[model samples]
Target: MKTYIYKIAALIVIATALHSCEDAIDLEPISDIGADGFYANADQVNLGIIGAYNSLQEKQFDEWVVTELRSDNTQLSFDNSQNANVPYRQLDQFVSNPLNEFTSSYWRASYKTIGLSNHVIEAIDVVEDATLAAQYEGEARFLRGHSLFNLVRLYGGVFIVTETVDASQARNLERKSIEEAYTVIIEDLEFAYNNLPDSYGSDQAGRATKWAAGLELGKALLTLGTSDSKVRAEIVLRDVVSSSGGRLLDNYEDVFDTNNEMNDEIFFAVRYQSGLVGLGAPFANLFSPRASENSVVFGGGDEFNVPTEGMESLYAANDPRAGVNFSTSWVDNVGNTNFERFISKYNSDFGNVDDAPNDWVISRYADAVLLLAETINENSGPTTEAVDLLNLVKNRANQPDAVATDVDTFFEFKLALEEERRKEFAFENHRWFDLVRNNRAVTVMNNHFATDFQYNDPDAPFFNTAPIQQFQTLLPIPQYEIDLNPSVAQNVGY
Candidate 1:
């Protein structure tokens, strides 16, 4: 069993947390503040941290809709065949729907985690051991900062809730500016990097570490897109590359192999269990061909996050990632003769429905290496050091790479960096944010709508509808949020 699999119910959470979306954040003060005091020891504080991880698992499952499906990486397998998949199709085509359930659930789960982490941060002072107290606080802060970083990137502005407020106050919370959100994210991650441990024991495999926080902090700085921020990011990311004890696996396929769990390459991942414990991952079934029956996995696949044909061409001629990430067709397990393609990263044999033990790897050394290359390029144009960094991942995949003379200008190097990241992180939920980070979402996606979307879903709205506008890059504030919190207005051009 994966460590950190504590019963989330051990944490003091509201009963309605997982299902409620009416409020911006749901919180309730603990009823028993008895003689022992609130969260008086390390174990109690750890429960809240586990609860935050639980919420992260829920939040991250929704990321493919907003990030991968919307990007050129993936799309709906059979857009017209699945009626229940309309919301996914809408996101795939960039439709104007503010009430997408996936979007709302993602928003609610993120704040729900922030609320739980806030409780941990506020209650950690009572722990007697200073080191444990700081580590616990750092973990909580890291979770909170991670949530805020994703929120600000996906939505232009979002409500900021540092302290646990009464559930009644949810209606009154106001969305803060993107600048303010980044400020809190940077501050929290900095604290996490300073206080978190460099590594965890064998029993605790997936707990947040100093290396994870530093990578995240560097990413936030790079996303902020200032010259000085890029320089600062370069310093932090370089340290993660050299001193964080992270190393890439020899084979690209081994990175996601179920048998090689928690290998040296993975820096952080949301661990899952395979028994009927209600804590296992759902991607194996969710990403498989819906009609594959038992051929792809136990039960039937949901056929979500299907890889696009366009994604196949993004890789180089000899690139091996396409074979590892996805496949072209499969025999009909139930004899339906289906050829739908699903992401193969999580193809482990599953028992019950949506109950596979594949850990959702959130950060790895290869990702950090590529981010370092990006920072190096942004700092100095087409530098040899930057090209060398890019070649590290390329060489692993057995693909041809430039000699630094080929990419003479900054723009060429930038394109190379983006393409490398595109293939390396395919179906890992990093595409849309990457485009926005490079300020190429509008141009690249518009071209996709005109060309690729036409090839994939030519009958969809693009035949008569318009491509995404500049303001539409930020997802619309879910209408359900505005319904509950009137003070929180919808994002512009929704």
Candidate 2:
């Protein structure tokens, strides 16, 4: 079991204490002295902030599946239909309904975080210590930004709740436009960028920092896709790349090694630890190969987020990361060679399927560098600088450098960078957002559906016969949410 530095006990206690209220009004703080008496001092304010961070842990399970499985990079795999997990498969095939469990959980958990952050932000002023108050406010804003960013990216317009609200208020609220929601997300991230510290000690290692906020702010701006926003994103990204003290690990495999987790390369991640009561991830059982002979997770694989063979083929013949990322074959308990490809990026020896210590990475230095390259390429045609930035990530995997001089047009340069990003971050839950951010989601995914079905089907006739409907791009607001709140409306074509 890996030993994580952060004290997860506090997060667990806070999560349990607030579980009932979280399910009630999405999330509301549970206080011994009630909301009026809560946030009376620095300690209480910090506890409130911790309550917000716990939502991230709650959201991580669906977040990974939503971003990666919906894209071409991964699929839910099992030998038989009986073993198939439909909640994920429905999403994978773009036939998901508004009542899909994972989608519903994502919505509820995201708003839960936002609600807790609002509580902290609204109450932090009462603290007597100025420095402590600012810190709490900064952390709350960072989390609020994080929640809204994820929400807005998935569902275009969303309900923007900046202050704590009652059930009646929530039920009566209207959805904000994408532009309006982004405005608040940007403002919160800007506050966090300016107010947060550069780094924290070992005890507080998982908390937000200035560089984390800056990276997120830059990402948020780039998502806008405006020329001015891209230019501004470049400025923020350049500072993060040049001065944040974050760097790519020399060995590509080391990035996922629990021993080397939270390395200089990682800007922010949801921390986890094994050997604790309630602090371990489930990726081991979720991604492991489905084999009855295996010892872990009761000798069967849940088989979620399994990588596609096409994704495996994208890497160069010499790419070292492929070995660490995927298991093309595994030895069974009886020592038979079973050739079944499965995701291995989060693979580690664990006590059970439910208890994995691997931390889920949110952002890293390489993501910033790639986005900087994207912004640079968008602002101007392919430049030597842009190619060099792509090469930095490529070189770490011992891959050959990209030849950008021959790439004469902006579109061609973008395709090159897209290929690099797809290979670099295949199973890391960045592919869907990358395709959407570059405006290639429909075309790329449409073509992918054709090829993927043909590849997965025993007969070629299935290819292109089952196409994803265009309106399936953005997920529908959960039906439960709409039933709970009268003012909310579902996404078009749901």
Candidate 3:
């Protein structure tokens, strides 16, 4: 990673805003007085926006775990005796509680990000340079929309805070309708797509770009699910695919190498540095099997989200990503061989057990292209255009082409696209959302539970499985937040 990436972490302190009352769910206690006088110069505004970017890292791990573990891609890796890790087990089992700490922490982290981005967006008008002000606003709005998009998808409707607010105002705020929240998300992303630059110089890499907004906007619109919105998504995503000047890497493994941090395929990534500066990403350390348990895997981790047998079975024997994404067997440091599966995609030897500098890519060109294929198929059933797009990804992975002849109907094409996405993006925090978006979360999970539930131990308490209720798709509102503000209502069946 470059030095400027670390600068993002260093500038977060300047952007932390302190609110008067600490208990308000919408109010952040960190002071934003810096925003008052901090927008006078372009350099200061740039630093402030970097601070807002750093906020994304605050919830990255929880976001991935919540999305991935809750879906079919993975299962909780803790032993039956490990009571300390029960919250994660509950999440994997679809019985997460309102009091789960991961739920509350992720919710608070998201709000904190929204608060910081609001500070930047609120102060941008003071910037004298018109071009710089527009750019800053675009960046801030993109960040804010990105945060809100994640929130709505995870919890349904949530408090839509666009501007900085005092303690009293925060106390009175309530959750907006899902449509209302998405309306704001679209508006912000539209402004971002229009104003953000198409690309940046080397020193300014990893910053949000016009294509980032376009891709995210397309995803948000697709999530909203209307004929017009899906059409619009196809158009926006097609533009990103054609003009973004990015493509699938020749080798899929190169895309994940720690030395190749921001490759051509990456549209945006959370930047990190691995040394003693304390800014490296923790995925490597946390994803690796515990050092004492499997030293050959390199690095130490609690091994929270191990890949499931179903996930392992998704790929063909010749698929290159299969080898890079996980390990079915490995030799321990002590020369004993083990057959347990573990995620190997983020492995990096650069940092210590606590920190590894592997950058977590949030979006990439292949993902956007695959999404484009989906939207195209959704708009018009089983077109060659969509088949070609899917094949492009398969070709890059050295896998056989998906026979379009077999996909004669819209329903069949949808299933094929879903499986491609599942295999392409497994363990990258996209499985749960993919299942939900396709309206298959309930059916797929219930079916998976019928046969694969209690995969580690067939006699475990939830050994058989319960049907996933429709309302359970949206997580319960954290009990801590509801207690703080009685104005907020909990999601049904909490």
Q: Please give the clash total of every predicted structure, in order.
A: 0, 0, 7
For candidate 1, the TM-score is 0.93
lDDT by residue for model 3 (1-494), tens? 35454483445555354443466664453465445755566776676687777767777868876798888888777444546588887787788889987887788878877887887787787788898799899998998899899999999989999887776787778999999998999999989999999888887878889998999999999989999999999999999999989889999899888778677888888877767665667776666665434374345667787887887788988888888888887677778777878888877666365567777888999889989988988899878888899889988878888886778788888898899888888778888898889999999888777667354355556434477888888888888767878879999899
Evaluated at residue 360, the lDDT of candidate 3 is 81
User: Which order, best to worst by TM-score?
Assistant: 3, 2, 1
- Best-to-worst order by lDDT is 1, 3, 2
C-alpha TM-scores of all predictions: 0.93, 0.94, 0.95
The residue ranges of model 3 lying beyond 4 angstroms of the native Cα positions read 1-3, 15-21, 29-34, 78-82, 291-299, 462-464
| Highest TM-score against the true fold, candidate | 3
For residues 363-442, write the lDDT of model 2, one tens digit per residue: 89999999899889888868889889988998998987876564557888888888888887768888898888888888
* Candidate 1 lowest-lDDT run of ten: 11-20
Candidate 2, residue 1: how far the Cα is off, in Å: 9.7
Q: List the residue pairs that clash in candidate 3.
A: 17-30, 17-31, 17-32, 18-29, 18-30, 18-31, 19-29
lDDT for model 3, please.
0.80
